[model samples]
Target: MERRRSFPDVLAGVVFILIGGAFVAGSLGYELGTPLRMGPGAFPLLVGAVVAALGLAIVVKGLVAGEVIAFGPIPWRAVGVIVLALVFFGFTVRGLGFVPASLVTALLTTVASKRVRPLMAVAVAAGLTLAATLIFVVGLQLRLPLWGPWLGF
Candidate 1:
């Protein structure tokens, strides 16, 4: 079988490599100590080198093996809905409280999926709220209100 270059992987590898380079560059501003007592720059620089290496590997693979990925259509609605849900969560978390904010966000994101029914969304939201409350509030003991000022709590 004839091998072809993988353009998508190459692109992703390049992006990762660039991001790693940025991390390394940014970390350079901070003082990096020795291996025994590593500084802020140490981690970032190491991550950057790893990213660059991975990118280089991908580029090499693309050059040697012919593997191409066809770009699929983007899911605009789902992306928009998830992003909107996060924005909503950010705005309402303090006011509405953790449970409500999580519920709303989970519900919105779930509903964004075409396969999810209204009842299913509510169920998922409720489950998410319960789990979040138990894990964050009861388990981890985060200093966040369950219900906010609106509920007179």
Candidate 2:
């Protein structure tokens, strides 16, 4: 026997549809004029349409399939770590510089991942931070400081 749609699933579908509709309506008011070509509204309008379609599909699928979607338990620890890391980034990025901020953020996020060991996670985070710095800062010629002025970089 097929399972029936639960209240939560129905609510989620309705919420998504409402949000998508709002985005579409908001995008319509954005001026669609530019000298070169398509204006700022074009991309948002496309995104809104896609969101609306996906929301509609979700609603239709839930109704037809009649299956209750079960979400797993929330990972509170991971959420906390991510939020803290973001705060740390915001506070430290300008003063401590990109490399350190990136490392700290990456390490926190990696540690939050369920599968990672502390040592391996640290190593991966360091590697990723270095790679990101090289790509986004050096290669892209972005003006981010490699190290703080106190460290004299």
Candidate 3:
């Protein structure tokens, strides 16, 4: 019989606990009304408490009988591409219009993976653009124009 503590599990649990605790503390600044008339702080306070409790449970599990798992190598290229895509989307969304900006961003992110073909990337990007348009513009009824002034629309 062997008892081994998982470093990764413990670290993750600690991080979660810290984040939850911070949220809980921050929420205290706002008014937390009664259950019937819940204020702005109530939701964050409750969620933070739950997260902290979960983190504590994870820490306990890690200490008792944690399974050994190896951390995989970081995907630097994918990370870079995704970040770039997000930045591009943010910077160009207003000028390029929602459809064009989202399309380019989705395409960039889709092509970040080495296995994705050009055609597949474009298809995925188009689908994503359509879905985003439906969700943000149509469904939510956002005031953003489909085609911006930069596109002569």
Q: Clashes in model 1: which pairs?
A: 3-66, 4-65, 4-66, 4-67, 5-66, 5-67
Candidate 1 regions exceeding 4 Å error are: 1-3, 33-39, 66-73, 117-144, 150-153
lDDT of 3: 0.91
TM-score leader: 1
Tens-digit lDDT string for candidate 1 (1-153):
577777787887789888888888898899899999998888888888898888888878877783767968888889999999999999989998998899989999997788888998899899988998999999999998999887788
**Model 1 — which ten-residue stretch has the worst lDDT?**
62-71
For all the candidates, what are their Cα RMSDs to the real structure? Answer: 4.1, 5.7, 4.9
Ranking by lDDT: 3, 1, 2
In model 3, the runs with Cα more than 4 Å from the true position are 33-39, 115-147, 151-153
User: Which pairs of residues collide in candidate 2?
Assistant: none
Cα error, residue 139 of model 1, in Å, equals 9.9
What number of clashing residue pairs does each candidate have, in the order they appear? 6, 0, 0
The model with the greater TM-score, 2 or 3, is 3
Candidate 2 per-residue lDDT over residues 1-153, each given as its tens digit: 574666555667788888888988998898766657878787777888888788788777777664655776989989999999999999888888899999999999887888999899989999999899989998999898888765566
- lDDT against the true structure, per candidate, is 0.87, 0.83, 0.91
Ranking by TM-score: 1, 3, 2
